[model samples]
Target chain A: MAGHNESGKKKSSEAANDLQTFSAENLQNNMKVIYYSQTFLSIVGGVIAGILGFKGLAGFILYFLIMAISSVGLIAKAKFSVHSYFDCWNRIIFDGFFGGLMSFVLFWTFAYDIVHIF
Target chain B: MAEDLVLDTAIRDWVLIPLSVVMVLIGVLRYFVSKLMRSYQVPDAKIVKEGQVIVRARNLRSGANFIPPKAFRARRVYFSNEENGLLFVPKGQAQNAQAQMFSDPNMAMDMMKKNLSMIIPQTLTFAWVNFFFSGFVAAKIPFPLTQRFRSMLQNGIDLSTVDVSYVSSRSWYFLNLFGLRGLFSLILGEENAMDDTQRMMQMSGFGFDPTKSLSAEKDSLDIIQHEWALPKFEQRAEAVLRKLVS
Candidate 1:
């Protein structure tokens, strides 16, 4: 029984290692899709926030809201079996969140200044 | 709160609009210029084959348990066989390969061209922005920032009374420089040369040494103890089905 348990532990560890192994090309392509989608959505969100004259905290809240909705949309698009496509839930939800933030703020400020300030 | 300064609408038309348009155009131009400058050299056949071999070994390592024991042993023998395996590299040749790469004039020239492509336009743009659009406030950010951001947001403007959220033209150029990466990725495809950050990272020597990775793959492949898991999976499935039926 002890030997069986040891073998089972080894098998489980090997399975874990197998799960970690992903095709680099596929992983890169998945990341690229997420990045592109986040960029497009964040820009759109920034434009909407600017048009609606959303203030400081409200604007950021809207950005996060858009990101959350995008994550949900991605999960739905994957048919809710995200592990088949991505390595983890974080890859689907938060992989490119910060990368998109700069573009979001840039467009946010641009639109805000254009419509409301200037 | 202090009285909000009313910026002239002319600044919007003349400075803001033109600055952004020119930056976008320049970005597009840089993309095409770099593409034209890039000389596509056909990689050596040996290197290609070695890379493919490494990939195959990696795949086998990952999927060893899925294949039958006999098949796994045959593949492992084909790779890790000490006498004449594909991964066996002569000690002298491996050292020569890296030294050959470093000594190649074409490689140096290629690096120089890439550096020139990145640097020339960057310097020119910085000079142009400084020459044409310096010394005035261009636009105000909607979000409030702390006083620490005064130097960054208010570049080329030296007013103690001005809020940190008021961006000057030079700083706007810098902002647009970093912020337009997403726009460039949208316009150009995923692998375009528009990102200076990526280019800078590349310049800082993130080179792939094939020999190092090849040996690493070989070592990992050497240690895999193959145990076919299919029979275990089949038994588990049968037990589960029997439980359901009973």
Candidate 2:
């Protein structure tokens, strides 16, 4: 509780570094895997959504189901407390957004493509 | 006889030859274009930044041997990064070094073994890329970068520390919305020098203002980020919970 006590103004990373006393420059070397995996999944999601466009209701439900599941995952991540005091703040927040937007996307795809397909 | 011969030549040579050529061209072009546009590559010169956080020491064993003191409690949670997770320090780095040296190996091993299956953040991890990115990307338009961002939490190397990175703008907006500056102040016992960052971002709109120009904004998918201060999914989760709750 007494840690991270320092300056009153600076960049978030710099401010955090100042509190650490020791700098932790997290260097990630391989990021292609992460990006490709995401893009691939999006395309798959897009394709499935394209096929399911045949059924108006089915299309809606499919995206809704995925997004709903994701949002729940976000809530879980946020509420999950690894530490009592200061939690992994960004972790909780990103989980929430990723889950929320994907759910929205899945449903939106159906909504947008339904008229075209059916 | 001439008209019949002309018809035969049209089918065998003129029509079929061109048709086959066009089909092959279309097929080859599709494959090449897909490969080119499937995903953008990270430039070899592009640098990937990362970091880690050690956690604080909680209830440890008190016995003579390296083990949880007779009352060692199963730790409920761990630091996102164990090295940087030390929220409180009894002494300084010197004391921590001593503790680490004398700690029981078994206990450390026990801590290392995690149920990784539970933490697997696969496709569902960012479930709503379908919602925002679907629309934004479908239109091939950029949008405002308002969502919570996640950088490499663990660089997956060295195993010494788990790295975490996030956008500065999201952090500022989060704190401002939930009055979290106070929360940070409360826990840290003092404020770090992060006050000026948000003001700078806001002035520039943190590079997120679709209304300002014809240029596109970053939609929700820009960084695949979210914030609890912005609604941590509990409200949206009512529908999803039906399976378990029912």
TM-score, prediction 2: 0.20
**Number of clashing residue pairs in every model?**
0, 45
Task: Show model 1 residue runs off by greater than 4 Å.
Answer: A1-27, B193-209, B235-246
Q: What is the C-alpha RMSD of each candidate to the true structure, in Å?
A: 7.6, 25.4
User: Where in model 2 is the C-alpha error above 4 Å?
Assistant: A1-40, A54-61, A67-118, B1-246
Q: What is the TM-score of chain B alone in each candidate?
A: 0.88, 0.16
Top candidate on TM-score is 1
Candidate 1 lDDT by residue in tens digits, B1-246? 457989999888898889888888998888888889888888888779999999899889888988899999999989988888988776767777777677767766877887887688889988999998899989888888998998999988889898788999999999899888888888887766335566666466434566777788889998878778776776666766777899
Compared with the true structure, the alpha-carbon lDDT of candidate 2 equals 0.28
Taking chain A by itself, what TM-score does each prediction score? 0.81, 0.31
- Give DockQ per model, in order: 0.37, 0.04
